[model samples]
Target: MKKLFSCILCLSLMVCIPVYAQDVDYSDEDYWYATCSKVQTSQEGVKACVGFQNYLDDQFNKLKEEMESYKNDLGSLQLNSSRIEELAKKQKTLSDSLDSQVKNMENQIVEINKEIEAVKVEIEEKQKEIDKWSDQISTRMINEQAGTGTNILIDLIMGSSSLNEMFRRFSGIERITASDQEQIEQLSDLKKELELKKDEQERLSDQIEEQKERIEEEKAFAQELQASYDQLAEEYRKVEADLKQKLQEQAAASNNIPSAGVISPSVEVTVPSVSGFINPVPGAYRSAGTWAYPGGGMHLGEDMAASIGTPVIAPADGVIIYASNPAPTNGGYLGNWTGWPYGGGNTIEMLCNVNGTLYAISFAHLAQEGFGVSAGQVVSQGQYLAAVGNSGNSSGAHCHIEVINLGSMSMETAISRFAASADFAFGAGWNTTATACEAGASAPCRERPERFF
Candidate 1:
């Protein structure tokens, strides 16, 4: 029993100490879950945690590579939604993968703990047998064929001081029954098994800790992207509002000429049934601004309010110039324009020909995932483009529609340079600060929907 205990101690010591790698593994699962960065929590007495910057950087880069692959697949800046779906999938995978792997690790840990306890109990029962037949186990071990000399037990016989002592030791070996020898061998097996369980537990615990860090960092970078996206949206809202004010002035010169206290709609009483251009939001009514707001804010687009899922169709045959579909349909506030094209939210812009001239028709505050068309896709007049949503700096559910006539630019050149810069204003001179779109200005002027729709 003393020898058995000695061997077990040696095995435990081997598990407890290693020559290299000062890192330690978790003994409890809570230790891994409760902490994200031990290095960051150094002053609070935490250890075995990951380094904040290096570990996070590695994970951030890996996920960025995965997201960038989707972006590259999309092939153009007009397809800003390319990375959003991939980011969502990656986030979901991170969650599911961590849950499954951690559950597996937990099950392994529980079984290993049970294994360790069982081994301890087995050793205890063996120790009890030693107490039951103390005299027999106290006798020296021996090799049945001393001449074969396989085991260290022969040392006892060879190291005897005298002929009488050697025979006496042989007699001692006779008292060591087969049962006692079997118990020693069983204990040896138990020691090896225990060491393996310990090592495996240590390894699994380390993997779980590393996995926790990786997942945490990935989520951190995603949140960082959200913050940056929101900040950019806020900044662009200022510019969008400013440019819109300037565009409003272009039409204000003609519009300011006459208005009773009540601004009247001049929509043609004779609605054409089989015309080239049609009303984009067919079932919706103007809720607020039309050409210009009632109080005359720089309303560049007409606001057509409708139910949340109201379909907004293309007014004429057109090619989709740009589209973004990342924001939530009902997640808009007064100043929240958080997506591509800055403050436009989930927007879609198409280049169409109306009245023998190219027109860039923009539909803003569109539904997020509810859009049926993608950027660069072609559609006929009255085709389903997207559903209306209260996104961006909007207060209610509606679609803000803007139309700019592109003079004589070819379809290829016009589509290529639609959103060339922040000052794009849908097309070329639509909002050029110097170009006044007063009553009779050229083709690049803002066209009124009430006058033509």
Candidate 2:
């Protein structure tokens, strides 16, 4: 019976030892790596792979969120820059206006001084005439008192030789008195005119001084605004530098992950009615559906598969706001490619207004040195814009187009409307909705090329 008990205990010990050997701490990095490495192409291996992918995806999402934050910061900085430019323009206008006003005031002051001087000279001449008349009257009064204590008119009439001569003498005496009276009245008018002119000059001077003070105030305010803008610009530069540093660090971290290339393509597509817009591409082309990329992010535009050297045209009348050769770098693949950092190669962003609504159209992945128009150039509907080619992160020759509503609609809504329009023109299956979007389960801001073609 003792030997039987011993055999049972030995069997129990063997079972317990195997269970202990099978136990694994999955949270440990070393253990996880070891287990995953040994996994073959089986159910267990697939599960392990999925788990690892999920972990990497989580990290990628975090980094993406950080990058988005930085992008928002950069957008704010751009807005600030625009504000500063607007303020500067306003300041220039104000300065010009003030300068013109100052010049006019100075001219008016000069004219007023000339008028005042003329009035002063006229007043001096009138005073001299008054003194001369007074002296004449005083000498006549003294002669009359010394000769006879009688009226000068009576004396003149009595001294006449005949009746006709007396009448003539009386007329002459009356004319002299009338002349002195006229001179006295003219002097009085001149004094009154001088006082009025001096008052006008004083008022004009006051107005000029007031205008100068206002201009100074306005100039000071403009200087203050400029200083504020400068400070804000400095602060924005510092923030931008910090954000760039953080982005570089996050990019380095993402590079360290091994499963960075495994991404799924699943999204929703829509169809709607066509409107006033026409197609941009005139020839044969295929729409590479939204979210068709394996990078697990919104394409933010529809890719049109076409042969190299295919002519790209403008869908509507618009002005080119941005046209440039993109930098030769692929941010996603970490390789030096001949294109933009975001893999769009040569790019153009145009602004078009339709039915009182502003829209921005972005064209990307054009052939190198194939741009037909430049920035600030206006192109009509169906005008040649560029040529299709495999530039940037393109797998083949294609044109990427993005339609952004510059109105009140959100990015998602604009994309949805664009997708519907494309579907109406090109039939269904042009766009789709997906869970693995930048907004996390929300619709992406990319539509099919048929919407604008």
Winning candidate number (lDDT) = 1
Q: Model 2 segments beyond 4 Å from truth?
A: 1-275, 294-297, 326-341, 408-449
Model 1 Cα lDDT, one tens digit per residue, 122-193: 556655654554334444343333432333365565676678766765655554544466765555555545
Encode model 2's per-residue lDDT on 1-453: one tens digit a residue: 224323533453331111111233344543443333331223344355336434534543554454344334434645353443344334333334434534544454455456556656765776676567556655653453344333445565566567876666556555545644565455455444444444444543554465456556545544554454344434333233233234334534565211211111121322221235676766746655444443333344577777767888878777665565653211111111333213456766665655545566777677765668865466787789987765654444577787654543332344344323321111111223332223343222333445546
lDDT of each: 0.55, 0.48
- In candidate 1, where is summed lDDT lowest over 10 consecutive residues? 260-269
Best by TM-score: 1
Cα lDDT, model 1, residue 390: 69
**TM-score attained by model 2:** 0.31
Clashing pairs in 1: none
Q: State how far residue 73 of model 1 sits from its true place (Å).
A: 48
Candidate 1 differs from the real structure by a C-alpha RMSD in angstroms, to one decimal, of 15.1
Q: What RMSD does each model have against the real structure?
A: 15.1, 39.2
